[model samples]
Target chain A: MSSSDLLLGLSQKALQLLQEDADKIEKLIEVQMENLTTRQCPLYEEVLDTQMYGLSREIDFAIRAELIQESAGKQIMVKLERNLAQLYEALSQSKE
Target chain B: MSSSDLLLGLSQKALQLLQEDADKIEKLIEVQMENLTTRQCPLYEEVLDTQMYGLSREIDFAIRAELIQESAGKQIMVKLERNLAQLYEALSQSKE
Candidate 1:
């Protein structure tokens, strides 16, 4: 394979892995949203926060390593952050 | 550049980036160790733990993206963990 092809393959793989991690976090958010009416687990927020931090670190590293574009990483993070924000908003409303 | 050369360059860059992160954590550990006799910051341990977690996530992503070997990632983590353990041990002893 050519050098470009090699780079492309690596970049694609990196993005896919990051997306998978983001999906996991998204799932966490969805589960919390679904359980909004039920008694929420106190530790779920902490768990989600930690997972988000971990995923952000991964995205940053991938960008530094040139495995993925910075914008691509930001896009993944932005989507998650939005979901996280909604989850928090819902949680607060539930508390009120 | 040839594909092999490209892969080699990417792999080396990934290793270097990971090492840089690990070094920062090592510095954190060293600083905490040095300050063990002084009044310790209550948040230092939590900060160190968070940093370690972030670095581990980066290393895991690099390995998954085929930028670095699994053993290479593990080696970086193990070295930092050992130093972190030493710092915690000193902290505990000082508290006793």
Candidate 2:
């Protein structure tokens, strides 16, 4: 299987395990982000590795898991790009 | 440092290690992907784990590494989504 298929399979499997509530999944992501910011993720290195392999996979998963239309992913991408810039600005400001 | 910063830093560092040719980075990704399908990535599982933690990082890396613009990320993401679907269809055709 291609990595994407493997990932999509895993995504389908994981979501099967989840309750299929878009709100819950979004909340889950939010909570995950909160956890990342609040705690030290020692496993960050490992996770980042998988990310290199399947960055597109999780993105595709989020699209389906959240029932986001194709256009929505674009908006999300734009928002995330802006958010990262804002975050960097905030961090840079704090550092100065 | 935040995870994004860590990634961006590593990305900057890796590119520094590379020769700063966007084509080289894209070729590297293509080669890595071809290797993935041709060989068994025993490390795939670990990488996948990290991916859940930082999918956005690699995407950003590719963007900067390739010198793709803000809107280009969106277009790339869309093409990727389509490519994945095509890959899946091809795989299923092979299996049947």
Candidate 3:
């Protein structure tokens, strides 16, 4: 495969990992949300609503962009996974 | 509230953001996975399964830990959001 193809493949694979973690997290959130007292949700709602807005954008810069973007994407996913694992642990502990 | 309470609140808020992004991404992934050719899943399954293992642990170091952990968690959530935004854009482009 060509370089773009390689980057595309890696990007897709990394995205799949992200999606997987997201799925597990959603279920966790649902359980936590349900158990949270009504009073607590109101306290959190302000912060949560602001952050829950959305996600997406694009760019067309010219210098070695595809590979750079692909590499950065992979690193972000790795960091995301590590942080997520930590967060999951902390949240679980909080629940107990 | 005290500093520890502040840290705990911030950590919980950040976790909520992470959970929100994960939910959106999971839906995106499900759509992509459904559309993916059957042959492709086998190739990607190994990477996906290994990464899917799990998430968590703890540390008991002595210096300014709660604040540090909370700050680190916030930063990770910020980075995670930015990266997720980028990944969402890239994946959407791929689909198109």
Candidate 4:
């Protein structure tokens, strides 16, 4: 289907997931909207880059492990959580 | 500062984390934006309600159990991983 056909009215949560699963062009739009509205365009762009270039490649390498199941993706979650802690610290520090 | 003053640019992850925090009013906007961007808005809205009503109360009860540090929030994370597994199952079910 065309991009226009993919357009759908999604709630905030739905929109965010679409952005995360931006495997198709239409999803790209949803993801961009998420970035634009959140004003985290930079972060979104970086995540996209990481997913496409770095993260996916890393996943491929991880496959060589004994058993890399779906949960393996969660390995990156710690880094993401750490980034959140850093972001909170940064925001708090800037405020103070 | 006023809610208007609290307006800030957040990355997708940052925006998401802010949504999770949603303590301040300005944060309310960031959180809603996150809910809107994601397709599982029903999920987000439910989470907000759970946090405000059921979840927070549960946490208060949980605090009595000793511990209840920052890491305590991760308790809900198990539910998330389960849901991811369930979600994939549901999607696959629907597709098939």
Q: Which model scores highest in TM-score?
A: 1
Candidate 4: C-alpha RMSD to true structure equals 23.5
Q: Arrange candidates by lDDT, descending.
A: 1, 2, 3, 4
Give me the displacement of residue B11 in model 4, in angstroms: 34
**lDDT tens string, model 3, B14-81?**
35543443455445445445555432344343332221211011111101122125455445445444
For residues A17-81, write the lDDT of model 3, one tens digit per residue. 43443444445445545555432343443332222211011101101122125455445445544
Error of 4 at A14 (Å): 19
lDDT of 1: 0.95
Q: How many backbone clashes does candidate 4 have?
A: 19
DockQ score for candidate 3: 0.02
List candidate 1 stretches off by more than 4 Å.
none
Record all residue pairs in model 2 with backbone atoms less than 3 Å apart, i.e. clashing.
A46-B50, A47-B49, A47-B50, A47-B51, A48-B50, A50-B47, A50-B48, A51-B51
Give candidate 3's iRMS in Å, 1 decimal. 19.5
What TM value does model 2 have? 0.25
Candidate whose lDDT is highest? 1
DockQ of each: 0.97, 0.03, 0.02, 0.02
Which residue ranges in model 3 land beyond 4 Å of their true spot?
Answer: A1-96, B37-96
Provide the lDDT at A52 for model 2. 27
Question: For every candidate, how close is chain A to the native chain A in TM-score?
Answer: 0.98, 0.34, 0.37, 0.30
Per-residue CA lDDT of model 4 for B1-96, tens digit only, reads: 332222221112222432343343234324555444344345644444334433332233223222133345445444443443454455446446
Higher-TM-score candidate among 1 and 2?
Answer: 1
Model 4 misplaced regions, further than 4 Å = A1-71, B1-45, B48-96
| Candidate rank order under TM-score | 1, 2, 3, 4
Interface RMSD of each: 0.4, 15.4, 19.5, 19.6
Fnat, 2 decimals, each candidate: 1.00, 0.00, 0.00, 0.00
